[model samples]
Each structure stands twice: as C-alpha cells, then as structure tokens.
Target: MTMRIVAGIVISAVVGVALAVTASYALATSNAPDREVEDAITTGNLRAGVVVEYGTR
Candidate 1:
C-alpha cells in the first residue's frame, strides 16, 4: 500500500511538470512573431521576442 501511494505521487509530479512545460511553450508561441517582421525592426538577421504588426491602410 505504501509503494502504491509513492508510485502515484511520482506519476502525478511527472504529469504536472509536463503540463506546466507544455503550457509555457504554448504561451510563448502565442506571444512570438514571424521571422520577417522581426527582421524589419532589428534591420539585421536577428530573431527573438514578439513581433508586432502595424498597418496604415
């Protein structure tokens, strides 16, 4: 019975970590911008952070 409880706790911790990682990646992707837009702002072949788009039409 003790072994079973320990196993369950370990499994739950692993699953929780996985879920947290997945959620973080999803949020990161949503905030990230495309490569081209980033290039225009930096004026170099650099890439990072969110890329915001603006239009005058």
Candidate 2:
C-alpha cells in the first residue's frame, strides 16, 4: 500500500510537469499576431509609423 501511494505521487508530479511544459511551449510558439495590424495590412491601409514602431521593437 505504501509503494502504491508513492508511485501515484510520482506519476502525478510527472504529469503535472509535462502539462506545464506543453502549455509554455504552446504560448512561446504561437503565430497569432495583433488583429488591428493584420486588418490594416489586409486592407492595404498599413502606415509607415506602424512599420517603424514594429521595427523598433
């Protein structure tokens, strides 16, 4: 019974770590961009100032 409890705890910790890592990776690799900027580009209304702002970043 003690061994079973220890195994359960270890498995739970590993699963929790895996979930945290996956969530972090998903956020880090996201391709979504700013909606307003995307709309401006799509409509051919993008401004020079916007480009400069992004460039400085």
Candidate 3:
C-alpha cells in the first residue's frame, strides 16, 4: 500500500540519519581517523536498545 511504502521510506531515512550521527559520534570520541567505522562499532538494529547503547555521548 502507498501508506506502507511511505512509512518504509521514512523509517529507512531515519535509520540512515541515525547511523550517520552515531558513526560521527563514535568517530569523534574515539579520535582514530585512520581506523574505519566498522572496526569501531556495529551499527545494527537501531532500536531503543541500540539507542541506549549509543546514548553515552
């Protein structure tokens, strides 16, 4: 349905933004420019749980 498609798009976009911000925060805090992000932390399952994990900053 159109509503479902729109919701999916919105959710995907939001997740993408969250991934970017979290990655940036981790990158900034770690102070390791040479190290890749995947080596820093896994950005999977952007739920309330993961949000709490990333909320330390």
Candidate 4:
C-alpha cells in the first residue's frame, strides 16, 4: 500500500514535469510576429487610425 502510494506520487510528478516542459517548449516556439511586422502595424495604426487585429491577419 505504501509502495503503491509512493509509485503514484512519482508517476504524477513525472507527468507534471513532462507537461511543464511541453508547455514551455510550445510557448518558446510560438508563432508570434517579429519586430518589422509589429512596427508596420503600429505605423499603419498611427498613420491611418486603423485597428489591425494580429490574430485575424
């Protein structure tokens, strides 16, 4: 019984670590825009009062 509980705790910890690593990797390699694109959007918005949604574009 104690061994089973310890094994469960170890398995849960390993899974948690794996999930955390995967999440970190996903966030690190996300599809966020670069500086030029952001600058262009900002410029357009400032020049023409346009509202550009990044996700839509």
Candidate 5:
C-alpha cells in the first residue's frame, strides 16, 4: 500500500511537470510573432543607421 501511494505521487508529479512545460511552450509560440516584429524593426533601424554613417565617411 505504501509503494502504491509513492508510485501515484510520482506519476502525478511527472504529469504536472509535463502539463506546465506544454502550457508555457504553447504560450510562447502564440506570442512569438509580436516579438519577431519588434526585433526586426529595431535591427533594421540599427543596420540602416550604421550603413548611412559609414557611407557618409
């Protein structure tokens, strides 16, 4: 009976961890496009500024 209880606790913990990881990954992918857009705009502006500065020299 004690072994069965321990086994049940271990199984529950593994399942809980799996659910948490899956939920976080789902949330991250869902929000990824906004992050990509922000990054692209910042990188593009930086690159353009560098190019113009070098071109002027």
Candidate 6:
C-alpha cells in the first residue's frame, strides 16, 4: 500500500540521518590521540568505563 511505502521511506531516512550523525561525531573525535588519558584524569577516575570513548575535543 502507499502508506506502507511512505512509512518505509521515512524509516530509511531516519536511519540514514542517525548513521550520518554518528559518522560525523566519529570523524570529529578521531583527531585526538590522548583522549582516554585526558578524560580519565580530568574526571578523577582511571576506570576504563569512566572516560568518554569518543575522540572529540
């Protein structure tokens, strides 16, 4: 049905936007090399799970 087709298209578009945003965030964060150290020390915790895994500034 036409409604089904329209719903499918909307779903695809939403998925595409999510993927693009994630990709952009990854790219932006990829520039920093000492991200883990910086984040851990700043937050006063050495736990691997405590630091933000992203490479962003």
Better of 2 and 4 by lDDT: 4
Let me know the TM-score candidate 4 reaches against the reference structure: 0.54
Per-model C-alpha RMSD: 9.1, 5.6, 16.6, 6.1, 7.1, 9.4
Q: Which stretches of candidate 6 lie over 4 Å from their true place?
A: 36-57
Clashing pairs in 5: none
Estimate candidate 6's RMSD in Å.
9.4
What is the Cα-based TM-score of model 1? Answer: 0.59
By the TM-score metric, which is better: model 1 or model 5?
1
- The digit string of per-residue lDDT tens for model 5 on 3-46 reads 99999999999999999999999988896777546866977646
Candidate 6 lDDT: 0.82
Candidate 1 residue-wise lDDT at 32 = 92
Q: For candidate 2, write residues 1-57 as lDDT tens digits.
A: 999999999999999999999999889768677776787789798656554345432
- Each model's C-alpha lDDT? 0.84, 0.82, 0.72, 0.83, 0.78, 0.82
TM-score of each: 0.59, 0.53, 0.53, 0.54, 0.57, 0.58
- Expressed as tens digits, the lDDT of each residue in 1-57 for candidate 6 is 999999999999999999999999999889866856786689687656554445565
- Identify the runs in model 1 with alpha carbons over 4 angstroms from their true place: 35-57
Q: By descending lDDT, how would the candidates be arranged? A: 1, 4, 6, 2, 5, 3
Q: Per-residue lDDT for 38 in model 3?
A: 57
Query: Which pairs of residues collide in candidate 1?
Result: none
Cα-lDDT of candidate 1: 0.84
